[model samples]
Target: MKNLFFSVVVMGLAACSSTPPAPDWQLEAKGSMDRAVAAYLEGNSRVEAAELARARAQLSRTGRADLLGTAELLNCATRVASLVFEPCAAFEALRPDATPAQLAYANYLRGQAQPQDIALLPAPQRALALSAGSGAADPLPRLVAAGVLLQTGQASPAVITQAIDTASAQGWRRPLLAWLGVQARRAELGGDAAEAARLRRRIAITQGSAADAPKVLP
Candidate 1:
């Protein structure tokens, strides 16, 4: 759970048969995502506001354009999604791609796209989940992979449990918060309201602690 804004256009381009050159709007949008990322790194709030403005502008112009380039769009969508906490929009922006990884990530992201109670995913996404390997398999890669797993329901129970355990042991707050939310959502989907509520409470507790501390891991 480090905030990642993968370009929708990047995903689309990777998944599509023919690659498209980056459009001007997309370049601008990409710049926004970069700026936001940099700002997040520098702990500068103003830069995030600036990037959010630029991203929304790009999204407004590109949202309805038919045949928008996928990779660029996904990149843009991911940025926007993070800003607004809207993963559905991010996934919709990826509809043109058919790759298993992309599909699984899209689904996983969609599951927790919003901040509340969710349900079982469709079959295609489930199928996609079956094929997903542990993400890039490094810390950053694991997060990327974990995000995909969280999104697609491909994440092994042990992996999620281990993530929770590791976060507790290492005192990594944000990932723990995110994992807590994801687990709660999954529990709710599985018809375990009590379990989901427990996870939700953990999320609140972790978030409270995180608010007052410097993050060791996102």
Candidate 2:
């Protein structure tokens, strides 16, 4: 009876454990923006537009206007706009908060920023490491970081290579492709011409010929 009582008490305590709050506007906005971009990239324009709309609405509701200026939020807006072919809206959205790196990334995604700008913001450099800001399940900030790396030209070789290598070793291939694709363009700008070419070739093969690969052809 005592053991049962103790076990019940422990279970009750565990059930009562508190969860942390959501991130502030900066992280929240970035996360929403990242989802919008991902939807766009995956050719889901409806979901992309909805996410972008949600992000914009959330940003508008925020009393903390300065949160938009952070590296995370602005980059997310830029990536979503670029993917959805809404460059003007994207630039307008980020203009108020654009850091030099952020602006450069936006412009590069829009085909206006210089290649050098992209190269400078490498994969490792672009990631805005979030600590204690958001929950681990929130992939938004990481997705935004990935976008920054992508916009700044650190995606292909280092970023994708790292993800693939990690995924291969960990058997985490499902999320790896989408995550790595977000960063692949960086290699295209960072002077890894051969690597970039190879990556593009792989992408093309996947897009064009993946269906042809022998599987249960039924």
Candidate 3:
């Protein structure tokens, strides 16, 4: 996910001996998906919206509602990595047309997936989709893994710190602030006032607000 090589997902495609020529949608979707993710994590909402719209349009070319739903799932996944927990309303609108695989992925993203859902997940997501653990080395995957762990009631201080460090190292302000906020909250709950203040300072610096950092974890 961090490297973004696996950004575009060609939903409902079965593996074949020889890969066929890439579809126009696949090519366009991949680039758009990559940019959308980078823009979202880097805190550029305008670019993220435009790129995600472009990717959705490309996926719509196939006339498969499931693909459209999958596009929304990808968008929600990026949002989740940045600690956004709103319902995936876009995917919900297309749910009636979605396949079991699509539903499985939706559940996986929501932390309500079943054991069967793991196989339906993209490779980078499978490890965390399966349990309370991290998998890939890429910063995005780790951030995603940390997000899932937090969702599943399994995140520890270490998980939050790692996610914060990963986002900071990548200069991903959105997730960096989000994760820092979470760490600060945890520190507050644990009576580590000094650590909490330090993290709040970092969050304030990022957001240009000296006020109390907003709650990003609930």
RMSD of each: 9.6, 13.4, 3.7
Q: Higher-TM-score candidate among 1 and 2?
A: 1
- Top TM-score prediction, candidate number: 3
Provide the TM-score for each candidate, comma-separated.
0.40, 0.37, 0.83
Off by over 4 Å in 2: 1-20, 23-31, 63-88, 93-97, 111-218
For model 1, what is the alpha-carbon lDDT of residue 182? 61
lDDT by residue for model 1 (1-218), tens? 23234422234322323367766776666567666644543334566668866865775585543223333334333332222235455446546644444444444544432212112322333333344533222232233335555555567876677556655654545455556666677788899989987887776666664334223211
Rank by lDDT, descending?
A: 3, 1, 2
**Candidate 3: pairs in clash:** none
Residue 166, candidate 1: Cα error in Å is 9.7
Residue 121 shift from truth in candidate 1, angstroms: 17
Alpha carbon lDDT of each predicted model: 0.47, 0.42, 0.75
Model 3 deviation from the true structure expressed as Cα RMSD, one decimal place: 3.7
Which runs in model 3 stand beyond 4 Å of their true positions?
1-21, 208-218
lDDT value for model 3: 0.75
- After TM-score superposition, what is the CA distance of residue 170 in candidate 3 from its true location, in Å? 1.9
